[model samples]
Target: MSDKAYDDRNNLGGRVRRYARVGGSVGGLAARLAGDRLFGMKIDRDDHAMELAQALGNLKGPVMKVAQILSTIPDALPKEYAQELAQLQAAAPSMGWTFVKRRMRTELGEGWRDRFASFDREASAAASLGQVHKATDTAGHALAVKLQYPDMGAAVEADLNQLDWMLSLFRRYDKSVDTSQIREELAERLREELDYALEARHIALYRHMLADEPTVHVPAVYPDLSAGRLLTMEWLDGTPLMRFTDADQETRNTIARNLFRAWYVPFHRYGVIHGDPHLGNYAARDDLSINLLDFGCVRVFPPRFCGGVIDLYKALRDGDEALAVAAYEAWGFHNLSRELVETLNIWASFLYSPLMEDKPRLINPADNPGQYGAETATKVHKKLKELGPVTPPREFVFMDRAALGLGGVFLRLGATLNWHQLFHDIVGDFSVEALAARQNQALAAAGMEGTVDGR
Candidate 1:
């Protein structure tokens, strides 16, 4: 079907139905909050947060995913709300076999069943936006077929409107962070995720970027069996990363090291990152190699932004205030007051601290991995509140998310390594020009030319 056909399907009626369905829950919550404010009634924030989570949980879609993302970002939402929403899982109730059959017919053709040697009636895995089924191709290769939920375009538009309202409500109550850019960034990435064709390109991009890294694996996409709302790929067999926590220290460390390479190598080498590091997004083989999955939430950064990341690390390590300011400027931060810079450095130093140390050590020996950056985030949020609201550059959203998410994983595995050496191994010879060239070549090779900054 053409893009216009898809758009026509998700017309005004679809959007209105979605809004009514989602708003029934979220709108009620909004009303309650507004009532509390108007009546000057004391609110039990924790209770309301729980109610909010329950509401979003029941209506799984982009809003629920946004809640999960917000929970990880410090001060993105109230502490109570973040804690409650953090418990929101990616798994949602899967569409029934009847719906799957119809969707397959729509995406492929009436003879879709003939293309597959066999296809499971049940979903192998289900998430907010889509569900995956185990299948075998005509060539007898094991494949994972991802089918997007119906009306997702309409669902995304409605959810984004609801998200904007929720953020606005929070802003009215607290002004620690200006979430306007954050919303825009999330909306863009979420919209991109709806296109499985783009995700196919992302898979190619990762395969090319990590081709030299034997420890990391990227799945091969089957274009013939895929569509805008459906993706077919080589199915990888592995154990979830969380299951390896109790394994021998060596095994655990190996997994952690491989995971670190899987995530960071692409970022440092090509100015790209797997934005979402949720545990479910990857797994580990018996040989300790990593299988990176879910290419939906990928971010491509400008070469200069990648350079700024390294510059900020060095600035913090060497106490170079001048270079630090320049790095912030490169990252799109404007009008950085001495106080604001100092405040921002607090969070940056915390993230970069694990990498600055020269000796082998756990990522954060002092704190529980679950509460990895909560304390520091609270401190930073307090300072920002006092300093007035600051709009973090959109790129900061996933960059920070990747750091904190991976840090939590490293802490969980108790991976002891000279992080400084590991980091230097990648960026020791880094240059903006070199990175730009490599990024362009890799992107073009993957059919993603001119996507980021128009090259």
Candidate 2:
């Protein structure tokens, strides 16, 4: 093997084993403790869950990021697991100056210092696979330099394998949700996220799509300084999305409006969805506009698929089971049997409830189904248990993650608005022929196969 590949493999192998060992041990302990003296009690469960979360957080890799994502999706984990995994969303500890210097030297070579006017030795934010540093360009523009942690690609793959093992253990512990489909989807999304080049492209596409939308802001990427492993963009300042929760109702509504646009504009207009809708991926600006961050988990759909979503919503609103089934088939769920379709509709109806209603729908913190956030998720899991393994269509994966993830954020915000109105405005001009034309145009523009015409 080449020297570079050898180094990547060896370094990653060490981190993976460390994480698996730590996670496995914690899972075992938590299982035993739950079974013994403190099973099901709130405090005991909380303590046990928190201990596992901290262990994974300290590991600070794909394992931690996966845990954080799973935490947001109800029924993906128990209440305590979800609560504990929430802690992983906080800023990770940054690497020391010595390590940062080494990374720079490795990626930019020894003369990298001459390329920038100034580069901060310290990181502003440390995430799962990388950290962001504030830097100044020679042209006098402020920039955010995203430096990938060394050997992270391999580490991510390794961590995913370990996560698979942990999830199996989880399934045995709690058979509420069949997480295999979820895990596979997450693995693909996370792998794409690790590729910074893909992230740069996603960011650029979003910038172009959101240009006319004033309330939503996506950073302008500096392509000259970006590489497969590194990304640099204009630095943006904003508060976390959570801060808006305590603001006045009007202010909160304004923020939510921008958020609604920020999320749906791309999906409806361009067939691309920002797959990771965690609170950390968005920021609340002082001007009431929202700042969109992290393009790692973006999903691109065909225009036809986008239309399929609308068709399904309309079908559910009108109680047209035939049309609804057709929409699901269009979405690639060929195995959606009659009984399964009914159960699936229970969930789809809930998701489309906000848009189906004339007035605003309030999703208060108290109204939260809590651990059973998605009734369909529970029903589907039960069905899967009875019927055996169901091969989920690939296209369904990322969109589901994005939908649930975004819904979780809205739940946290507790901001109510006329969701149906905004949704309608996005796809007001929807047409099958027009959608097909646009889908082909986008595919040709991106130099990708044009087969994704909502098949």
Model 1: lDDT equals 0.87
Q: lDDT for each of the candidates?
A: 0.87, 0.73
The model with the greatest lDDT is 1
Error of 1 at 114 (Å): 0.9
Pairs in steric clash, model 2: none
Over 315-343, each residue of candidate 1 has an lDDT whose tens digit, in order, gives: 99999999999999888888899999999
* lDDT of candidate 2 at residue 154, scale 0 to 100: 70
lDDT of 2 by residue, 87-196 (tens): 56646788777776666666667787787999998898888778999998899888999987666767777777777776776676556456777788788888887778
RMSD of each: 2.4, 4.0
How many clashes show up per model? 0, 0
Model 1 quality (TM-score):
0.96
